[model samples]
Target: MRRVVLRGFSTEGGPRPDRTALLSLGLVVLFAPLAALSLLPLLWPLRLAGVPLSLGYTVWACSAGLYGLRPVQLALARLLWPVRRPTAAERERLDLVWSRVLRRAAVSERRFRIWVVDLADVNAHCVGRDLICVTTGALAELGDRELAGVLAHELGHHLRMHTAAAAFLVWVLLPLQALALLGSGLALPFARLGRHLRRTERGFGARRWALIAAGRLEAGLRLAFAAPGVVAFAVKNAAGREAEYQVDAYAVDLGFGAELLSALRWFEACAAPAAVAPLVPGPRRARHAAAREARPTHPPLERRMAAIIARLDAAPAAVPPQGRGRGRSESSRTLLP
Candidate 1:
């Protein structure tokens, strides 16, 4: 159980993005089609929202749907498409927990299911109504209070329908992922020629040569046509971090802010010893990550903790003191992580 503190505490900061971020994000408008086009065929089997169409329409509509429903579909895909089946006991326990939480959250049980995956990773997330997966490691590492906090955070995603919001982003990025792959392949060859051009321009004092080099760089970028893809990928990731803050706010509103904060801290501690693994590169990963700024789905842990703290300060809660307490309080049962 979470130990309630009567003292007030708040998150360190709030969400804000500058003009450059906004400008960068604008690129998504153009790139969404590319991602939608690429990812549509893969998702056609789901037939979500009853918008089945001719093959041509499938591509067009899917590109459009990427903006609206792809996230939800992706979430469903992640939740249900397990590489390994869950143990029966774990499945039953997870179902019970999910059923109870859904009732409390006033969500339809039919709309979602929470499944415990036996993976050892300390992570838990919801992809769609059909599947919510919590790694066994995460459950084992956290106390019941902390676990509830994590669940509440995930539940916040369901309540706010963040999957749909995420789909809007995916529509723009599916194409970018492809472009990134192409761009990475071109990186070495282009960089070598680009360096020679720059050196020749400096040594020979050639204005025309410099201009030509600049044009080549521009042409190379255009040929690669990676800007829209790159920018879309970056902003899509930025939006995901923002979504994390919004979900944290949801936990606070539900009176589990402290628990969530504690859970986050514990998760960070557990993850600290592990070397930071590259996300996409090499045989197991993609390579473009080295060439560009890396944007990720979650906010920085310190920043996230700070945001939670700031929220706590702005609106204090009367948490009942633990252990030496008088009569048992109902609120104690609903401890935040």
Candidate 2:
């Protein structure tokens, strides 16, 4: 039942750090390119028709196109994820929490539509421009403040257009994934052939040498096809880690740093031990395990917590005013007037 208080480091009365400036920088770097890419398919016809579009015009067209897809994306999300409508009691709680969060963040209440899934995992994510999905386990486990923190973290993703960016990037990377799949398919026959040769080769003679050569050929082919995708995957995950940090900073700016940190700790505790276990005893085993853990799409929880704490320490203490319904009695601040 301990509370985490964020302390400010500025003592000289220097100018407060600009949250707007930071948000703007994140938008330009993280959202702009993805917005442009999402527009590309829609604008292709204009370029094909020889409309002579400028770069600025093209970007405008793309933004419009991406905006148009929001409804369709929301529909697809509902179909794929299949969340149930909130019951009367659940709806009341959701409305209270969401309204307070929107008021605190100064965002329009209509901008986001919240969905609760029947999943058991304590997870939540922003699906599209407006769709915020949370698992039932999250609702059951998190207090009102913790739930608000989780929502704020997801809201950060929405505000920065990270979901759109991710969707666009996935489209861009589809071909690379396909190539990797194709390579695996192609290598399967060669691998089978090598295995067959090894099985038929009865002794250490010409047949054994031929079997070794076949195995080598199979390995080479697999590497040739899989290497590009392997590199791309690594790069994509690296970018994803940075994006996670950016959104964490956004949540802290929303005055939910302590809650989010606590939520993350809960997640770490819930995760399987092997998922976060230290490297194995041997030197090589430990080294390889370390590399595998480092390759995940999000940075490790310890690193993320450290980064958020550092950012909070440097951030101005009074940027976002605390919301009215942030305590155990938050349900009293319902949207029902």
Candidate 3:
């Protein structure tokens, strides 16, 4: 058996303090004191029984909610993000590239399962502990090497336990999200009533203005209630973008730097039309421009490519040339078998 060592590639990219995680942690810390104070009255009786039940019950409830609902969450994930087994042709094409990547990483084939999703977006991701999902568009758009690079990047996420962390974070924020949803639900009737009033021809000028004002008030209230969750989402996505960079570096360390760069360039090219189409002087262009501003979960392709290039430049000798002899060479071993 031939051993392929990743020279100069340390998996220990030390202590990336995710700002989103920190923000979430900070929110929890802040909430703890407030919760303890708010629940003090209710928990007074329990405290009389020699239990610090205010904080204790809060902690227990949260822990139970997160852990107990985990299995249900996993099941829901599968249902929501359904993927199919790859067709024979797809399997054959992907297996060659995937097997090579696995061999390079020295990971057991049994440890992970790959599924093809019917999505138009050119992307792939790691789900949970052992599931890697690739979109049909990704297979269509990326070359074999580029595809391998994507898979390697997702694998990096898996190896780093990012998926698990993300799951846990989602669990932590679930109640907040539910509260936001409930706020929206409660506000919906008021909004509908206001709209109905505004649309009524019978209404006088002042009445019409009053209905509009009511609508605005309801909207404001809804937004106020949902603001925390919205802020949390933005923070979480910011951290997620940082994770993308880390995973990109991991792929680079695995000797897929150039391939990943190429893949990013391909994404950039694909996005160019949507980006440029908005700039063309037309009414639809405004909508297109607005759509273009809608941020994706991952960092910008240019930023990701730059990060990968930086990694490549930092360890130029670590990227072994393809088709090189297995015998000792100055450069790192070829990652693609």
Best by lDDT: 3
What is the per-residue lDDT of model 2 for residues 122-241, given as tens digits with 9 covering 90 to 100?
667767567787777777766676677778777766776666555555444444455556667777887887788877888899888888877887788777766654665565555555
Q: Which digits, one per residue and each the tens of the lDDT, describe model 3 over residues 212-308?
A: 7878878987887667656666665565666666667778788777776656655655544344321112221110101112243455555555566
State the TM-score for model 2.
0.66
TM-score of each: 0.59, 0.66, 0.66
Per-residue alpha-carbon lDDT of model 1 for 1-337, expressed as tens digits?
2222221212222222323234334545566556656555445565564555355446654554443353555444544434234578666655655564555455666765565555555667665334456777655555554555667677766555554445444545655566655655656565666667766655456654665776676567655656665566556556556666777776766666776776666555445343343332122111010111222655556666667777787432433222101122233332322
Global lDDT of each candidate: 0.52, 0.58, 0.59
Candidate 3 residue spans exceeding 4 A from truth? 1-9, 12-74, 200-209, 271-296, 314-337
Question: Any idea what lDDT model 3 has?
Answer: 0.59
The alpha-carbon lDDT assigned to residue 237 of candidate 1 equals 59
In angstroms, give how far residue 112 of model 2 lies from its true place. Answer: 1.4
Q: Which stretches of candidate 1 lie over 4 Å from their true place?
A: 1-30, 33-60, 63-85, 183-219, 222-224, 273-295, 313-337
